[model samples]
Target: MSPAATRTDRLPYSHSSRETKDADDHAACLSNWQQRYDQLSAGSFSGVFEEFCFGNVQLFREGLNQSVHQSGIAWPGSRTFAVPVAIEGTGWFGGEVYDAHSMLTLGGSDELDFRTPRRLEILACTADARALCDYAQQVDHRNIEAELAARSIAPASPEQVTALGKLLATMMASLRATPALLHHAQMRKAMEQALFATLLDTLASATTASASPASCRTRQLVVAQARAYMEAHIDEPITVADLCIELGVSRRTLQYSFQDVLNLNPVKFLRAIRLNAVRRALKSADANGRETVADIAARWGFWHLSHFAAEYKAMFDELPSETLKRRI
Candidate 1:
């Protein structure tokens, strides 16, 4: 944390939490997340998050010991950029497992299933997708989504990710300590634009290696094998490295194959399949039976009911609760 804000700082919105040790505390800290979960019952919960909403964007730094999965009919009305500030356990976001060297970029309407086994810390900022797209064109006159898919979660250079993380840390500190500076509308807008520009630059610098024809064929095979593996192990936790080891290919190769052929991140594809499987189970079972949404979701490895229900509804246009409530 930075020095306390002086009277001169003037940011419009500012909120934060010390740390979360219980379910109620965690839930309260993440009210803006628009998510509901039973972190208390799950156990081993610890988390914190801070937010600064200014101009046309929202910035936050959040950390948790539990996995997070969210789904909804529509995505948030802003583009999102997430970078790992620090990570201890394995987690998946932006369709890619959080690595020491990667960044996740999502369009306004992108649905995400973020999961982790241990501690996961992230710095994220959200701005209107249209606004960001227009801003990109104004700067470079290029289609930002074309080059980097609307929801691209590719491997980024470690150096760049680290740099962005540092910048976010500084920004967070400033927001916390310099409230007076943010009160000025002009100053706040300038700060917002500068942060957005930095985020864009960091994303534009991410490098995903191009694959050759032979490599592409290899990736296709890898993708098929990987899909098979995911289906076989749908009920268990799976990781990107696990797929790489199973297919005897480098992580980079597998990543490229999925992006080139499926246009989906492997992690996300796995999640989608799992969600579909859960839906099928729900629809097939006797609605009159005692099976609850949480029970069924847990069977499919979805622990957060609210996140699961939201996601379930987004995909099928109905809630998991609705699915479980209707009789055959």
Candidate 2:
């Protein structure tokens, strides 16, 4: 698909508001991030993305209606800080569960893995890595480069998180209400400074915890190995027994590992991953080509057409044929 054109009327800065019913389209709404989202829950997908960019700072808000697994990287030379303003259920970032009081940080070029629940709303700030480090050093006399590189999630006081969230909301609201403010050089600089100060203050109050136990790390590794194996053999038939044999673990241990790390059994996780793979293929298929839905499903290990269609509709709220027909 061609990239969405940027709005030129906003002038020196960029502002965009987008709504999408397809998970992949929603994933593409954010600028500069290489993102992919797979819907994990059973429902029609709905998402809203709003972004404002000026100078080296970017702010965005994302609201998603379905549970989704997001994987990608932020802009190449920036660091991102994100917090959930509202969430219906729990979310996991880099294999660790986080709540409203937790902040997610990712360095430029770092891989991102997040599992978010339905009705999730998040506000995120991204700034040039060098600029962020310089601001922290100048204002707080603290060097945060190492901290940003090492941490994926940080625990912050409720007050700190709430204040940061409010500040982000205000900045976005102000820009959206009076976009001409973005054209004013002094106003843009002031907004950028305010964002940096608030974000740094929030980080300054964060508390770190001890590392995970060796046993826990082992389980995480098992989960990682299983995922890699599944991804490599996505088009082949796979079973939990097969995974156990390949990974050299007992069935119980494999089950416990998946449940502990992802809060899901092996069967469900495998099915979800394969289903998403099929969806991607269907969406990208040539509209005038000779491929059928059954062929794609079979390629993803779904041998039964009726069952595959039912499961596809149940999870994505659309038949496989419908998805293929609506390919863009």
Candidate 3:
């Protein structure tokens, strides 16, 4: 254990016990965070953040047999985030102890050192000590990099940190519209999976450095089996039923899943996707703006003038005629 805050610092870390039960107030929590911030400046963290906790989550603060000296600037006492399978919305904020990495499990136990307000002893909580069995599990990196990291955050570019902080702060702001999904055992598991998926997408986008265009064959793969059959005999009376034969599902089932997952369907979806390729070719042609809408449409399998206009309008908002005018 470390010593509590001395009177000199402005960070108003309070000394409340776990049994107090009233520490969960959002107002009080925010106030404490402000005071802590007053005392501590950014750029003071160095550690493998082992675990974390918030007000009442410290189930065994006494058991750890701890002593921490409070910074006149830093709030007194360490707050460790536990092995939180899930913490819904209450536990983080803009200026508060937003412990993102605390949720990750570490194989070795941590012995954290601290300097006053700016530097902190890792917050101590019931879950600070990771069991050997638990360490094997790997997890996602929350999209947030600490705003104070050397790469993206600095006093010179303070707004960058501020902007990132606002984003992280705003996350889960709407989640409370639902029930206590954070504390729920099973819901937390589902959320963990959800968060993991979200992390994957975020990491991919961050590393990829572009909104990579959706690929044709990859998109076609959704309708590939059905599409191959459709293309084999464009003149044959191959309807949605024929598609069902090649794809191995009833028409309705196919439509529902394709529309639900990919936001497109078996027939019209294929037509739009195929036509999109043609449109791209026409727009980027070496002899730019020469191709007529009807020429492009016919090249991509659209024949009926009225139906082509309707589908084009539905998909691209403008009429095929308007697209031609622009191209001309």
RMSD of each: 20.5, 22.5, 20.3
Output the lDDT of residue 121, model 3. 25
The digit string of per-residue lDDT tens for model 2 on 190-308 reads 56666776776677633312222337788899899998998888765565545766777644556678899999988688778778988999999998899877667655545345656
lDDT of 1 at 54: 59
TM-scores, in order shown?
0.53, 0.60, 0.24
- Which candidate's TM-score is highest? 2
Residue pairs in collision within model 2: none
lDDT of each: 0.62, 0.77, 0.34
Tens digit per residue, CA lDDT, model 3, 1-328:
2221222443222223222112122113322232211212333222212211221222111111111222111123322222222222222222233232322211112222211222222222221122201211122112222212222101222333233223222222312232222233323232223222222232232323333433455445546666667678654434444455456544444555566556777666666665565456455554444556655654554434455678778878887666555542
Model 2, 120: alpha-carbon shift in Å? 0.4
Per-residue lDDT for 227-327 in model 1, tens only?
A: 89987877654555456556766545666789888999875776688688777777787756787666666555453345567888888999887876673
* Candidate 2 all-Cα RMSD: 22.5
Give Cα distance to truth, residue 322, candidate 2, Å: 61
